[model samples]
Target: MPWTPPLEADALTTLLSKVQQWTPFDGNALLDDVGAVLDDVVPPKEDLDVLAQRLRGHLMQLVNIAVTAEAGDKDPEADRLIRQAHTVRAEAMPDDHRRAVGHLRRLGWTVNELLERLVAANCLREAA
Candidate 1:
């Protein structure tokens, strides 16, 4: 049997719930993507804050790279949303896991979408 580390209730709930919603990918493709992103990302019992920060940092960096690769000024509204998500992620909230997952949920749109909207929004902002 493969060893599975314990995960926080809320984080586990969020991950499983999101995975359950993905129907387009056959078999384990969706799970594979999720696994790829979360592989070895076990958070110590008292270090949820650090884990949340690291996850958000990855998302923020992807968003920055996507936004910066565009020509001309970015759209104010799309930029605002991405910035808002970034701001929400910067705080050290008590429900750090839930809040971080929630931000990902809102930002990504679907289980496999994963930052696509933020990138699209940034591109649209540049086009606007």
Candidate 2:
């Protein structure tokens, strides 16, 4: 079946073509902030909601960049990023603070990995 995107077809095509440059998404700062928060074995869950929201956005962008770069289907690393993005999207915010903390921490790790893979694929502005 042909699936429809939320965006209009022509608009989405143009936007995705530009996404190949992987700009407007700061992987360095994102890595730093996520690292700082997850540095502790158990980070406070108070900010999990905000962090998760940001991470979700970043993951989605990463997936789009991967697709634009022609990495999503054939490359193993991009495939991993796509799968992880799907996982996070399917997940819900954990009610228990501890679980929430754990989930965010894991997402932190995933984002870090995705950035590395993207850099290696020459998708980002600079090596991450």
Candidate 3:
């Protein structure tokens, strides 16, 4: 059966394309701010490494949030971001690369819909 998307075709297309660039590793903005502060201080390698580790820790803390299924009462925008982040992170999985695919399916995105677009995008070698 042909499945209809929750969004208009164009919007869904845009979303699929954008999701490729999304990251579950959050805190990039804060990391940039930390980088700016470090720039002013002319930090040594050890200091910079420490800063990077701290930022990575913060990002790891957010990883679970990114993969969490959206609550029925959650804000739509926030859910969208989390799902996108999860989708991007799914690429790193070994055996089950489609965890985010299942997540999106539960959220009303059909497997065929995603697969059609993904296959058209050449399975990630070239971003859609």
Candidate 4:
């Protein structure tokens, strides 16, 4: 399983509720073109904070769609993908900018895979 941040009881409960209530038209799914999310995390801004936030937000987007689609009954692979995003988020990044960018890029690919899966499942319209 992909490692996720430890969830508090309340947060877990809320996620469960949202999952239970999700529909194909659910607002919880991330329908944005998230492809450029890390475009800024290049040479000038690969600092710890910048990369961390981007990573978190990226994972959140992946997780949101996966969970929502799972609820919609359109995808059973959601759980594994969600876990993979969690794993990427929990890993430590190197202090070197190049290494950091590489780490973030790995997660970026994971995010792209989730987006692709969502599209295949008919949960998201492909952005032009």
Candidate 5:
């Protein structure tokens, strides 16, 4: 299914809750952290189009990282791809997005692992 933009605070909250529930951390703590972060974000008007786009970019970066990591050591091309991904992430993310990205980065998760987990969470959320 195509991604749907979050229109209300409740919707975003629900998404956050769903994502947090699927996270590896203690469910309560993850939910609390997600709530704290959501409290800071200014709700997007009409749609979460910008946030969605930023997330898509982030996902693509993770894909690049996964491919590079799987290929072994950092060659010139891998280095260039990683650099490009970092640049895109820096340019696309806002403060809350940065925090979310930072939290994930600190988790010591590989790109493929993150992608798989996120996709599974999103799928489950949609199913629910």
Candidate 6:
């Protein structure tokens, strides 16, 4: 069956797109905030790249949430933003990439849905 992106995934994608053009300092600041949230959920890792990738994944989820909040209106820009986030997330996280592909085979979740949950959980850590 074809993969269906989850609502959360769509939200995160939208959020990321809005912040993609942020200044370097702004991006770093956002990453730091996201990292702090993710640290609470995912185990501490020695590899900075791994940590950054995970944080990026979380940002994607935020985008999905943002998109969903703005739903029911004509927003081609939001759709474009979500797609850009999808591309970045797919390329950045190897573990997630593998899990997403595996999901295709086992029917766990569509790539989009898996990404959404992964992102949502990380985002939730900030709240918790």
- Per-candidate Cα lDDT values, in order, are 0.47, 0.75, 0.39, 0.63, 0.42, 0.44
After TM-score superposition, the amount by which residue 84's alpha carbon in candidate 4 deviates from its true location, in angstroms, is 1.0
Winner on TM-score between 2 and 6 is: 2
Q: Sort by lDDT, best first: what order?
A: 2, 4, 1, 6, 5, 3
Worst 10 residues of 4 by lDDT: 25-34
lDDT of 5 by residue, 1-128 (tens): 99897899999999898778552323234333333334445334422344334344444545444454552143454444444445544453334645545433322122223444433434212111
Q: List, residue by residue over 27-98, the lDDT tens digit for candidate 3.
A: 345435344433434444334434434433433334343334332124454444444534533433223324
Top candidate by lDDT: 2
Task: Provide backbone clash counts, one per model.
Answer: 1, 0, 0, 1, 0, 10
After superposition, candidate 5 runs with Cα above 4 Å error: 1-48, 51-72, 92-128
What's model 4's lDDT at 75?
48
Off by over 4 Å in 4: 1-42, 45-48, 71-77
lDDT of 1: 0.47
The segments of candidate 1 whose C-alpha lies over 4 angstroms from its true place after superposition are: 1-47, 71-77, 95-114, 118-128
Residue lDDT tens for model 6, 1-128: 99665569778798788679453323344445444434334333344355445445454555656466553134454455456555555553335644433322221112233334434444222232
lDDT of 4 by residue, 15-124 (tens): 88988965443223232323344566364543555646655675676577667657335545756667788888788877777777777677767776766776777767
Task: Please give the distance, in angstroms, between residue 14's alpha carbon in candidate 4 and its true position after superposition.
Answer: 10
Worst 10 residues of 3 by lDDT: 104-113
TM-score of each: 0.37, 0.73, 0.26, 0.56, 0.26, 0.32
Task: Give the range where candidate 5 is weakest over 10 consecutive residues by summed lDDT.
Answer: 119-128
lDDT value, residue 13 of candidate 4: 88
Q: Cα lDDT for residue 121, model 4?
A: 75
**lDDT tens digits, residue span 10-112, model 2:** 9888878877855587767687657755786565567678888887777777777888888867678789777887796558889999888777877777777
Steric clash pairs (candidate 1): 75-125
